[model samples]
Target: MMKRVLVFVFTSWAVLHVRAQSFSEVTNLLDSPTVGVFAVGTSIIDVNSDGLLDLYRFQGTFLQQPDGSFLESSGDIGFKNEDGSTAEGSTVFGAIFGDYDNDGYVDAFFEDLTAGSRLFRNRGDGSFYQANQETGIEIFSALQGSVWADFDNDGLLDLFVGGDGDPSGLFLNNGDDTFENASANVGYSPFRNVYGVAAADFDNDGDIDIYLSSCSQFAAASRNMLFRNDGQAGFTDIAPSLGLDDDRGGWAVVWADVNNDGWLDLFVANQPVSGAGIESRPGFNRMYINDGAGGFTDMAP
Candidate 1:
């Protein structure tokens, strides 16, 4: 069993690890020794506005001490509890941090597989309250991952929750601490197993677009989707025309300027035999190069 979580501090070049074996065991720095090792996921945020970054481990939370140590205070802050009770069931697929309410406090959004999807609002006192039902995002699905983006350019971050085999949903910010199921109203319902949901201004059109990494074997469903942002809460699928319709077991997608060409490009990670895939097909990674005209060309073979 994994007894400790290893953490590395990269000091030198991002391309090369100048130091050999720079990892240090943080099993003793955490308050809950068991959770420090068992926590498979984590996020960093300053919940207390103390200028120090705190940690949100899947099992609980850890606040950074002045001396650089960590203290687990999930129960006290209301993010997690001793009984590990969540919104519904105990299985958490993932969690994201965002100040959805514009209250200057970073809130948390969790995606659970069995009706446990919840939005925990930070009360500014190092505590959180479940605001799912009040926010109209008490959604449930065979979830995988989630992302926060300002789809409407309303200065409020919206949410996009992905699913595996189940269709995904996009909740738009209502500017009143509530979210509306814009996917249902806008007819952008995507029924596929989505592993990753990435957002960026790929076209530099001042509006954010979305790239969905999906896993499927069927010809019609296997290809991933790239939704172009058309102003005023509208989106159009332009993945096929851009040649980014990869039909393989997909997992993750990221945007970067790999060649420093002043334009954003995309990199997609795939699995030849993914667990979420329907059929076994040898797949390769794809790097989509932007043509500076809001178009993409798959430069990878």
Candidate 2:
């Protein structure tokens, strides 16, 4: 099924060659204004609601562009500020697109390493406006990954931020174009340097919970942490009993029911950041198939 999805996605791109371009070969479309390192785009979205997924990219430095090849304004592109500026020092990592405000328009969120994160409210047109201060999930210095879920069962979306620093956060949607931080009280503080976070209602509890990939000072080959939402205030750490915190160099993660047993399984990609050959190819992506028991076993091979 996953193979078919990948083939269909690539074949559809080949069919709509003009509108859909793969991120692996997008150097020509980029407008090089400043020094930057362009990695392959890891996420895609239609920020303008034009039915075409715009590339959400991370260039080591910033750049400029002329706007062609089905590319829009590179909306909300980051700019380097002077020494005393608010955004003076930071590198943007990843971007996710969603209709966060229930306004029927897809918006954008960005994760930066050195500075604070950004939430761009879609203006219903082609452009976007930054509402970081307005949304209240702003941070000073941390690497972040943004994920969305209807956390409180409020029919509105909330955000979870996985950080490279301790005490990763959760931002609840206030239903009024604003957000509230609820992580510290929810057992998400003292996070021990989290990396990637993915949310799902794994226990059929109707309340969204979280699973995180953590890399900290204590965690050399980091652990995959899990948080269970208890419907009232805070969450409980449930990774140890479920056998998900094995600490095997876990980095990026995604969860799905591979066997369709009504239980969501997990898949984690690992790249050793502390030991030898950290920048090599063919890193391992381990699959954890749910056995309907309380524990999980690695099924990658």
Instruction: Compute each candidate's TM-score over C-alphas.
Output: 0.84, 0.75
30 Cα displacement, candidate 1 (Å) = 2.8
Q: Write model 1 residue lDDT over 1-301, tens digit each, in one string.
A: 0211111112123425544447777767776767325454467889777889988766678899998888977777886556766332366767788888888888888767656577888898768888989999877676767888898998999998886757788899999988888786555576567877788878776788888888766546667888888866688888888888788777888987666555679999987864465566777888888878867777887
Off by over 4 Å in 1: 1-28, 34-38, 82-89, 217-219, 274-278, 299-301
- Each model's lDDT: 0.76, 0.66
Worst-scoring 10-residue span by lDDT in model 2: 79-88
Task: List model 2 lDDT by residue over 247-278, tens digit each.
Answer: 65567788777665666788887665444644
For each of the candidates, the C-alpha root-mean-square deviation to the true structure, in angstroms, is 7.2, 6.5
Query: Against the hidden true structure, what lDDT does model 1 obtain?
Result: 0.76
Candidate 1: the clashing residue pairs are 165-193
The weakest ten consecutive residues by lDDT in model 1 span 1-10
